[model samples]
Target: MPDYSFLNLSPAEFEVLTRDLLQKELGLHLESFTSGRDGGIDLRHSRSRKREVIVQCKRYTGFASLKANLEQEVEKVKKLKPERYIICTSVGLTPGQKNQLLTLFNPFILAPGDIFGRDDLNNLLSKFPEVERSHFKLWLSSTEILQRILHSKIYNQSAFEEEKIKETVRLFVSNDSFGDGLKLIERHRYLLISGSPGIGKTTLARVISYHYLANGYEDFIFLSGSIDEAYSLYNADRKQLFLFDDFLGKTFLHLKLGRNEDERIIRFIERIAKSDNKLLILTTREYILAQARLSYEVFEKPAIRLANCILDLEGYTKQVRSKILYNHIFFSNLDQAYIENLLEKSSYQRIIAHKNYSPRIIETVLENISTIRPEEFVSKFIGYLDYQDSIWKHVYESQITPFSQLILANLLTAGTPIAMNDLELLIRAFAERFASKYGIVYSQIAFNKAITELENTFIRSSRDSKDKLVIDYANPSIQDFLVTYLNDLQDMMGDVIDTACFFNQLVSFFAYEGPGTPSQRPRRTHLAVTPYLATKLVNRLTQNFVELPSSTLKKRLNSNTEPYYYQVRRSVYNKLNFLRHSNLYTNNIAMRNFTLEFFKLIMIPNHVQSEDIGHYVSLVIYFHNEIPFEEEKILAALAPNIETLSDYHDFKQLEALYTETYAKFISKSAAYKEAVRQMVDWEAENVDTLDIRDFVDDIHAIVDHTKIDLANVIIDLEEKFQERDRDYDPDEIYDHDEDVRSEYRAEEENISDMFDSLK
Candidate 1:
């Protein structure tokens, strides 16, 4: 609908258009046209009625504030007394660049932003808008060695592979959270994505760009730094998807730009990104982790988020990795037996075998794969651990960095003490899930040693407190510091961890049950404790406990101790009575069963938050067989209380300090909606009962609803906020000193009185 084709104009084509307009309209004749010289202009003018115009053209994607440079060049041409001077840029100058251009007071025309004032220039730009549509809308399928790779059909290469890849995509997309990102993309007017290096940023970008291109969408133009090679892509004619890989041209974060000239470039790109309906997709590998929380300033965060769409690219999970492997091998000689053997034996080789696997290392490995070069293929695998041998050679040789510390900060967030058993359990559990993506060996020792460091660094224990380990998750600064240093040498640290617990758990599981999909794996309660589960437990208690009235809890406790610190009192147990009827009480049942069998217990995760719901839904459908009215009622009753949760209770009394945390149930509606939809779709369609329902169609329905809902919610909230602010009178609220809302004098008196009391 919008004309976003800015990349279709060539310098010569633009020059011709301008020259033809001048000649036809003004009856001006030129002897010859000459362009592009290092310095000094060459112009042959035989006509006297029409003035000779000297032009400088700059075509670029990076910071395009060349207006000052153009002005200087114009001044140089002025000294020559050239009758006219013109500057044309592929992208355009910023407001400041245009202001600088106007300051010259030269008798010349500046096209685009410089020539047209603000809205006028943007209005002109609106004539040729950028693409803001889906890849499917463009009918463009994947171009990522799609034909070549699919022809080989490596993952299903032998035969009947299409079905397998489809199955793989289904499996990968099954994790409801995995695709939450796509909603942001489709719902917004502007979006930016940033992630750690080698997280499939470019691959996701390529998939997005090429998919749109193949769909016959003409309102979009694709551009990357590589597109610069085309030379004619910056014209106002090209508008579609612009997939830029390795954008944000500045290299190191701390390093300063070479000259003032650098600022000009930044100014240029800022204008392009700020423009409406124009999608500029970019990728970068390096960004500070502190930039995780999105901010108002566009530059503050490494990622993009605007009115349009913003989808982040997190790398493949265990399911995705297995699917990828299957897809790749299926195309070639990877037979199901060989595939199963590889699947069974091959563990995830971390891109950062020493740290974390980044998409670049993954891409580098895959890109170099060749039938002729087995060693190269091996090198790619080894490269996943490149830093171990190369970057952190000594650390690996010595095995000194604490492995727990590496992933600890990331692991611990709920303000609770980190338990050794729980920490070990988390590491093993996570490793197994995406086992093949990162080359992590199962270890319990690393978990234990890391626990020692945790004790030394942040752990505090008191005899009076239940669970004894006092850890505050709210203080993320310390966690941030640890995560940074630890991830830097994760490879060296991994070896330091003890694998006994990891191996023992595996042995126990093998003794009882065989390894396979989710259900086939050892049930969590049967294995060692995990920190993720521990945190989930803490969060869950926060939810349920906070919901209970503090007055009743205070009466129950009857002592000067936090409620959570006390043994399971009547206050908490009585509340559980309300929960037992719901299926979400799985963890509750497990906890009761455990305490009944043993004596004391730790925390348990709510059914609402856990990924177990996917498994739960599967079980429900399998048992029901057909979706009868009674079955629907049973399913509805058991559905995660995500949207139904209306009340949020506060544990703190008198005057409560406030912070917001969403109820897991309240936040999971979108994910749960898809989960339920997929369950229904799975029941409706023919899905292999052997594998969990990988229902694509129902998943799309959920995705579409999510996107629409997000867009509507964001827009609606923004409108209401704006409308509410419209009648605001700031002066009226400047607050009279007697307003009493100000607690300054009272607080000051309290402070003095408290000091006197201490005396």
Candidate 2:
């Protein structure tokens, strides 16, 4: 049972609920409206044609103070002279207070049992379930909540107009085969409804659920918690309708579940696919449904997936949109007099025909029109919806609390759904650090309260496949709102570096040593951020590269450890890939330079995994193409380690470029050739003592020597050659040519060995 103590209702709302209860339960005709005073009575009713009853509602909390309020109402009762008077209070009076009230009023005028309090109201509401739904709707599950919403004061049986929907649905045969879809559901026992938000998908699902409930379905189960919980709730022996809202994925934000939940869902589907009595109805946003198919491969299979039962509600005609808008507005709680006046205005036609109009937009405009004059509401609302910035600003300012703002900043900075517990930690840490900056001390209780508030509006929390609660911004629109809002705040405060570092710290959890043994250690409980999301966070954070501190960038580039070696390197590689594929930054010099520096920091001196060699080489290629000043240094550092290249396929491109560039540079350098010749002559003279490896090392060292000295060394070698030639006999000259050829071939073999070692 829900705790009634947690039920918070304002005075006017409580009175309205009381009036609804009285009207529904007592069969009373209310003669007075909720607002204006009718001789200080809240409601007037007549039991018989001649007998009048007066009701006064006081939502007082203090029992001691009830007598004072009662005395004031007692005076109004005496003046009205009703046959019966009833006083209603949210808090029941104490026994002494009640006895005191009874004694003050004349026994003939007021009876002892006429005073109704909270307990009495609860009993009345228990008797009228429909009234409870109509008045108090916030604290209920899905089907009940939707039932109350659909049958609200603005929308009721007469206002539903299913026939109009049916007529409109027929126009888009390919869009919504409503009859065929239902027929497929009957055959398959599973129906997946996919559509854009506010496109009548949930409304249609609710309509179907209502139909099944009307047809004697025993239960309406809204999915939450685990699939095991869902399985326990399902009864094959009874007729049941399971409403899985946003079944394919999250409606407001994108989140990836762990493999366990997907497998559970697949198993659930397998069971439901063969069921006869159990029916499952699922609704999801269109793109999310597609993503689900990718996430769960079984969803793509024809036999297990129930592919034929899928319905896409697209291709909505203008006439249908207008009808949908009209139905929502007609039954909405807008002021009837203002609605009537606006219906006559030509400006109203513009609202109906406006290209930007949507049911959600219209509903938002009509939700609270009491603050604005009815005559001007529609016109002003239409103008408001036309401006996207205005809507974003209004939504951001309206829903964002300070704690929630910090949450948004972190999520936006993280650019992924953070685990709920981890997110709370982030918020708490951020609050502690920026306490003086924000001018508020935050506690855990405050953080929890703020999170709950966010969940009701902009933030959404759901269990992933791992059964861990993860939180995300409700949708792409919310993300957009936060990005713009927080970017401005970050600019003014210059805290992007701080935010980036916080997320970076969280991501370092990915590098945790290991899960270890179960006997020695408990399971690791923390958010597991995907590599894809990590890449996204890095990309987003770097968008403010100019503002990022050098120290922060240095930390970002520190990916040399074993745990984060691949993850950070991949993040940088992915960013470069994005730049390569995208046109947004054709010549982003700062990003290019920053990424080059990052590559320099992450480059491996030894062998990388064969699988990752391609990614490593890609980073090298990016340096060669983008960072001219560092290209030669990067290649030279990598050149000595070419033997570490595990796969030729991974290094084929790099090999070709390195070879072509080295060959071209060598051919252009006469000084380099002279240096090589002198090194060969010196090795020939020292042939008996010199090792081939040592000789090759000396040749490499000479390549870096000055040109003038290399020429002098060559001249000295030529003089030695001339002196040797003069001392030799004519016959010995031929013998000398053969010896020189032998030495030259030996040196050539040694040079090839040096090149082979590099390979």
Candidate 3:
């Protein structure tokens, strides 16, 4: 029942923290966010001049809940200028949400999900060769019997706010970068630092109190007692901002707040509000809880006048962790090839091991580094964090395909309605592999302490239980899997393939599992576009449409990104290489003009009405992106046999065709012009929004000059038909108001005869 820590790192403190994260944790460099104008872009960690990175820290309590808001805010900052954005929250993303979130934000990151698909368990084997797959799962799931243990403390904001920050001030002091103390206050304001238990709180608070007392602001006073005593201290010649270390009520009567001496505090703030020159600084765990209750009376004024600007200080992220661990800007003795290889091998097991890479925790891990190898150190770390037993471990190790009734194949894979046998088999394999690869292993009774974990992580009741193990990945284990595995896998494989494959496969098999592929459908799988999938799908589709080569894929994926994810059309052919070669574009070897092609990755799988809303938007956008030109022009130029917009048949024929065309071919039509304009406008607005790549299951006709011309072919045909009817049936009544007169046959005949005689 105490505040977590006051051992919060000040901005000056982050200098050392950044160096620690970069050098020890990541093979990166620490570029401070000295420019406060940069939203939350705290630092850049790059291995080489060519490789750039942007580190964003969201030091929030419920960090996951805040991703959407921060993502939007930071993205705006990214677009204000060209800069990489690797936005990280000190409060780590929920496990399962990781992949979904990453896929959703792929364009904004340096890499797509291609490199980090959690499914790529092969990478894990390579990274942690010593980890026996079977024992790992058990140990990870059951801490009592397992050799090691992990405990994901699902932070209750309410409980956190109750304790307040008056307790652990020293730990915060330990990491405080400012040595002399008083000058340290110059860097971070509104400094809100948070972390796990035992990290540091009261210690840092004491240190901060000492700091302000030693500084010029000696008039300030600290108060943490009953309401009357607290209010009396409020009578001092306080600075413009009064620092309230414990805003939560210390007495039962003061709990609800806004009364008694707290009233006096409110009146004081009212006077300050009138001046527009007052500030109120306060701290409390009560501020961390759900509906974080900060009574207006806690401050010498109304709540808004004091704590309106909320900064949820979280534990440390990798950047800060690295700084605390290593004493340098970037990795000193750390090996880049090693980490990348490990990432490629373990596919991000290290990230999982370094789960709570908070400054406090990372410091703990590093302090004991000599006790363990990097892999062992990480394994031990994750085992104890309660973020282990990831569902990714389930998917990667088990044969998800066998569960016919509840079968879990790549949702994009070809499959039929599952039978019970299939579902059972699927779960069985899931269990087996889940235990073998990721289960915790040890010779002790660690499992007994982890009954909760089994219910939370394993899903099954026991080791041999066969009940369905489907879980809402939001649980720490499931979420951890998503973050650690799925996201990692997605980054491992190309986005076009990963996003489209998994989401589409799921869309196809589970809901509409009965339907077969459309006649002549492309070999590729369908993709899903929750708002999370929007921007990423766009990037993949953009590359495919622009005809980026496979070889250049890695280079593009590794580019440092800011919060700004790519819009389908903006970065479609826009990304340029150092030599100005674009991954999505190629030199026209034959025609000698630049061209964009292979834009299929962006296609949505199903046109189902009930599919992902983002996908539907993507389908519509794809239509909007098309240019109107006749099929003949396209044929003559790139001469794609692919379907054009003329009729349903031509459109249908384009299903499997991978074709290319010059801009000239599609630039001729007014309709094409409109579609392109609308698409650009839409991309401008929604690029970073969700659902740029919609893989429709129904049918997707490539948008081209001919296609734009064809979308309205029926209108043209009907017009021609009306013209023919009017010319042939002159006697027929039409919508026109004009009258028709009949001719006299006898008069015309006589005139002809007379003319002949005269001749």
Best by lDDT: 2
- Candidate 1 wrong stretches, greater than 4 Å: 1-190, 215-238, 258-277, 288-298, 301-312, 315-317, 332-341, 344-759
The better candidate by lDDT, 1 or 3, is 1
Displacement of the residue 139 alpha carbon in candidate 3, Å: 48
How do the candidates rank by lDDT, highest first?
A: 2, 1, 3
Model 3 earns a TM-score of 0.23
TM per candidate: 0.25, 0.41, 0.23
- For each candidate in turn, give its C-alpha RMSD to the true structure in angstroms: 26.3, 29.3, 34.7
Query: Which ranges of candidate 3 are over 4 A from the true structure?
Result: 1-215, 225-230, 234-243, 249-280, 286-303, 315-318, 325-356, 363-376, 387-759
| Number of clashing pairs per prediction, in order | 78, 2, 146
Every candidate's lDDT: 0.34, 0.51, 0.32
lDDT of 3 by residue, 1-759 (tens): 111111233323323333333333345556664423444455666556545566654434454555665656645644533234454433434456556555555555554322222222223334433332221221122222111111111111111211232222212323222221222122222333222332333334444443333223323333332223223333223443345544442221111331144554444444333322223344444323222233332543344334343333344333333333332212123444323333344433354236444333333444344544655544554543443333235333542322211212321121221222322333343434433443423212333232233332223221102222222111212322322343334332232233232211221211111123222111121222232333343344334533432110000111221011111221321221111221111221211121213223323232222112222223323433453333343223222222221222333333233234334445454544454434333333432111122211111334443344333433433454555445443342222222321111110112112112111
Give the Å shift of residue 195 in candidate 3.
8.1
Top candidate, metric TM-score: 2
Q: Over the full model, what C-alpha lDDT does candidate 2 score relative to the true structure?
A: 0.51
The predicted structure with the larger TM-score, 1 or 2, is 2
Residue 332's lDDT in candidate 1: 43
